[model samples]
Target chain A: MIDLLEHYAVAIMAILLGVVLAMFLVLIFFAILNRLWHNRGISRKREASESIQPLIYSYLDGSINRSDFAARLKNKHDITATWESIEIMIDNLSGEERKKLQMLLDLPPIKKHFLRKLNSRKPISLAQACVYFSKKTLTDKSIAVRLSVLQEHSYNVIAYAATLALVNTTNQGFRDMALLRFLLRKNNASMAVSDIIFKYYDISDDKEVAAEKLEFFVMNPDIPDKTRAAVIRMFPELGFYQTADTLRDLLQINVKNDPTGELTAALLGVLIDFSDQKLREIVEKHRLWESPSREVRLKVPGVYADIYGEETTRILLGLAHDPELEVRMAAQRQLLKHRPLISESRFEPDISTEWRAMKKSGDADVSNG
Target chain B: MSQKVLIIDDDPAVSNFIKYRLSKKSYQVKHVDNGIEGLDAIRDFEPDLVILDMMMPGVDGREVAEQVREHGLIDPNRIIVLSGKKMTDEIKALFDIGIHDYIQKPFSIDLLLLRIERALASLKSR
Candidate 1:
């Protein structure tokens, strides 16, 4: 019985030893796989560096143009790898090697490409992109980068980028609606389409072309009312002088007719752009100053005052004593622009208290009117 | 002689109305929906006059008018174009293509009758 028990114990010991050896083998296999994976990753990175190595060498040897370097770099494959490799090469270059690179960059294409990359890639910020693109010193890459930035997600960045693109286009001696449409569709951002339109009136050198494009915008009902109003304001740039009547028609028919407060203000801005003395009299005669819609009275009327100064001043003075606090406040604010040497203390009314009183009076005035 | 007229228009309502009014006025008329059929009907019927609608689903009225003028079977002077939309720069191209007269859409039936009468009377005089 003791001998049988000893044989069974020996068999169990052998089985346990075999299990331990299998476990050790599996661990070793896994460790080898993990090491192979790590080495593969390192090799891939090295291969990428080697692929970009000649471009870096060419840059250091002064054999390639800057523009050519930039165009190749801009191609988007292994950019980070190539950039890092180039940096290492630049650092390792001796004084003579560095001077060769400097001389190579002086080549036209080299200078153009390097400057373009500097403008396009140097600053990551949208605002920086806009400013860099707007600079006269920038190469064409600046304009190209600016266009991409105009389609940026940030509103302010888009606005700045759009403005830079527009100014650049204008500097290139072309005026067209294509740029406007491009920016609007891509950015979905507008500080004021109308504001840009208004600026075109004075800035566009060709009257016929400016008129033709402006007419197309006004006729196209697809554009928003604010943009249409801005386009109407630019009619004066068409040099027809007959645009005043067309503007008046648009203001009366397109804006005031719809009863949209924002559009009314936009039309009023168009009227201000007209700057005709006769229209000022019409405002005075109609007693538009007393209208209850603060938009019409305050907003629209203020724009009128800005253009027809003395008459607007008289109209605003009457509103300064208006029963509606909003009307009074708006009138006061409009008056402030015309007031010279005016301090903040000269016109700081108790806004909180006045706001309540104005609300009460505004309701009362609406009922009475 | 029954002075036959063919109306080529995409809108059924317009074609029917014109056909009904002209037939009531005692003129024989045939109507077709598209420009191709309108041209074929003109060739078959040899109508004294053809009233063509400018905008159509296929082979627009302007192209039909050009084809008719090209065939020389129908006199260019006898064709009148009726368009529902406003006159645009494209109308100049129509004029160059031999469309004699154009009447904008939502036109009064009375105005159309007058135009037809004037055109027929001028043809008689010629």
Candidate 2:
């Protein structure tokens, strides 16, 4: 028993010593491998920095554009340090060198940083930065940044930021109108646009600074067509009389291409507000009251009422007999307001029970054509 | 109970208009500027009805509605969606999430109050 115990003790000591030695060797192996990896990584980074130095120097010297810088540095991998260096380089650039740096910094990351900062800060600097970048003809990036801001921020912030940013760019007045349109595209956002109009234009009274700005935007062809179309749509609300000829031209041109009922309706609304004599003349010439587009038909009566006053019932009497059910329904609504006093001649031949008679007519027209 | 109603919209004008009208009818009203505060106020104020605006920064009104339903915070029936823009898909989306009524902006205050009264009265009858 004593001999067996002695052998067991020796075996235990050997196992403990073996484990300690193995652990020490393993630790040393890991430490060496880690050191080697660290050295290799450092050397690779240094080599990369040396390789990127020319691009950086060129960028700082104002030879390359911002998009190219973003593309070149995209794969440079050391984002944090790289951006810091780029920012520092941007700060040192002189004259046109500064412009080039500004252009190069127009990448998404830089813009995203601006967006983040704008959310928490006053945004005046970001707006100025955007304008500075925009003047260098950075349309693609500038537009993308502006759109993102529009989609993601409060309308007030977007309006304030975009308005300031547009001040230095070409056709800046037009850009503001486009931004407003984008901001206020949906049914819910009309009120906000109206608020902006009220704040800027006093729309109800027909004398607002915002109205003059919109007029300037309309006259600027340097603005894109889409933005122009949107501004034209808002013209009636602002009651810009100078655009009457422009509005008539647009309405005539627009009627040829499916008569965008909503826009026509809006234009009609404006002309009604202005009580322009030309409005009735154009409607009579185009036969817009009986036009295929429900949008135009719905709009005609309001203008007719506004132009001839509510007592002049001739156009409304004619409109009441129109074939398009929606138009007839709209006429009916107008007639209903005058109520009990409506002439028997204006009574429809067929008062169909279908609730969506106008909707059905629209569908039929679409299918037949 | 005061029949308290809360409005959560980013548009100050909208929230103010609703607050002013609802208070005139003697309904206790509270307003919050965005969805995050809106959610927090729901817990603290515990309004009888909530008028939610659909679009906002960070967390939108739809997500706020979803959170309310998932957590059983506000009664699903008492929520009214207020928007200036109308998209059928959005309406269907809100409907699927359990919003009971919707009102478009630039509304007549009289019409809105009537709808609220009807919705609340209908709920009581149920």
Candidate 3:
């Protein structure tokens, strides 16, 4: 029985060693293959850069006409190189040069090449095609339809790229549908979302229509608070001060109910940019300076300073004694930054002492530096 | 003698395009891919006008411009910045260092040629 067990153990050990040796040899083979493929790619890129780039430059400079340039791009290699050159030129050149390049995209071979890429099963290839289409002005209904179908792709990146491509189209319905699909996606309230919306807003010919669409998103309670806050922040940046009253109303309703303070802070932050006497009255009525959320209170001093200017000294003096260090520091900084419209005689003795101490520390830091 | 212009942009597409265009206009043009070579070319090539790109991998256009001004290798006004950045405080500060002009990227080749002509003309006048 002992001899039989030893023989079985030795046989197992031999098989394991053979398997390991096979794997090692396979890895070496792959490494060599990979290096050869890498070298080939590098050489091809070099050849393209050297040979095709000059022909493109010539065509652009009008030394050689379009047909002559097209005739030179005979093989798959030449076409690929020309495509690469076109991508670089399109990105870095604009005005008349960009128009010339855009005309190049309409060429049958180039258009067909990219259209085939759009139908590719590879996610990267499909995404690249979507981005390329996004850059060009599209009149093809079939391309838009393909993009719309790709918008539902299982891969998030491909779907997002497809959505962006659809948004670039001139069709309002397509743009609205794509944006809605994007915004309604679960947990999609991100900076990228804000950027896409901003781009959509920027491209809209009718500013009013775009603003109304944004306001719809802001007012919709179904939208997540973070997403709403992002949309609200866009208003002031985009010069949509017309939404000031609506934002103030939202703040009034949500301030007491807001647990995270994000919505309140966003509303306060934007309203500060549109600061006025009416805003001050609303802020004072809401008692936002004493709000439980430190983030909301932090914006209060700036709001007060903008509306009250030097007269903010009194309020800032009161705030400088607040429980939160950040709030106190914010109020103190405001006091030092602007001279009071009110005279020094009006300051309470303790408040005056606190102001003097803050000023001394600020000066000491500056001089020390 | 043709006036010499040195291009210090990292993008070969941009630099090559400018070189081809400028060579057509009979200006002696040379391009370097980074700031260190740019500074060396500024000294050795001694081009009359330098077309500097603002953003680069190491020692950016601003630093190169600052070094040039600091070393007094060339007149700060002989440098024109080609940037993709909008008119911000930083770009404004570049002008404070006395670069000749700032052209935003995605610029028309024609506009660039025009600006190059004007910059060279201004340098000649001075």
Identify the leading candidate in terms of TM-score. Answer: 3
lDDT digits (tens) for residues A1-369 of candidate 1: 999999999999999999999999999999999999999877776666556556655554356755666566443334544544433333223345444443443445433443455345333444443443333223354455445445443564555444554544554333353345533443223444544554455456775666666665665556665555545544544444656665565555553344455555555655665665565654555466665556667654455454534455556666767777677777666555555532324333654344346456655665787
Candidate 2: pairs in clash = A66-A103, A66-A104, A187-B84, A187-B85, A188-B84, A188-B85, A201-A208, A326-A358
C-alpha TM-scores of all predictions:
0.33, 0.37, 0.83
DockQ, candidate 2, vs. native dimer: 0.02
What is the per-residue lDDT of model 2 for residues A184-284, given as tens digits with 9 covering 90 to 100? Answer: 43332444344433334431233454566666654554544434445566665454677777667666665655434655666676667667777777787
lDDT of 3 by residue, B1-126 (tens): 999999999988778989999999999999999999999999999999999999999989999999999999999999999887565887988998999999888789998999999989978987
**Worst-scoring 10-residue span by lDDT in model 1 chain B:** B11-20
Error of 3 at A44 (Å): 0.5
CAPRI category for model 3? medium
Interface RMSD for all numbered candidates:
38.3, 23.4, 1.2
Say what the RMSD of model 3 is: 4.0
The lDDT per prediction is: 0.60, 0.61, 0.82
- Taking every candidate in turn, the Cα RMSD to the unseen true structure, in Å, is 32.4, 18.7, 4.0
- Model 2 residue A262 CA deviation (Å) reads 6.4
Which residue pairs in candidate 3 have backbone atoms (N, alpha carbon, C) closer than 3 angstroms, thus clashing? A310-A341
- Look at candidate 3 and tell me the lDDT of residue A367: 82
- Fnat measured on candidate 1: 0.00
TM (chain A) per model: 0.41, 0.40, 0.78
First chain TM-score, candidate 1: 0.41
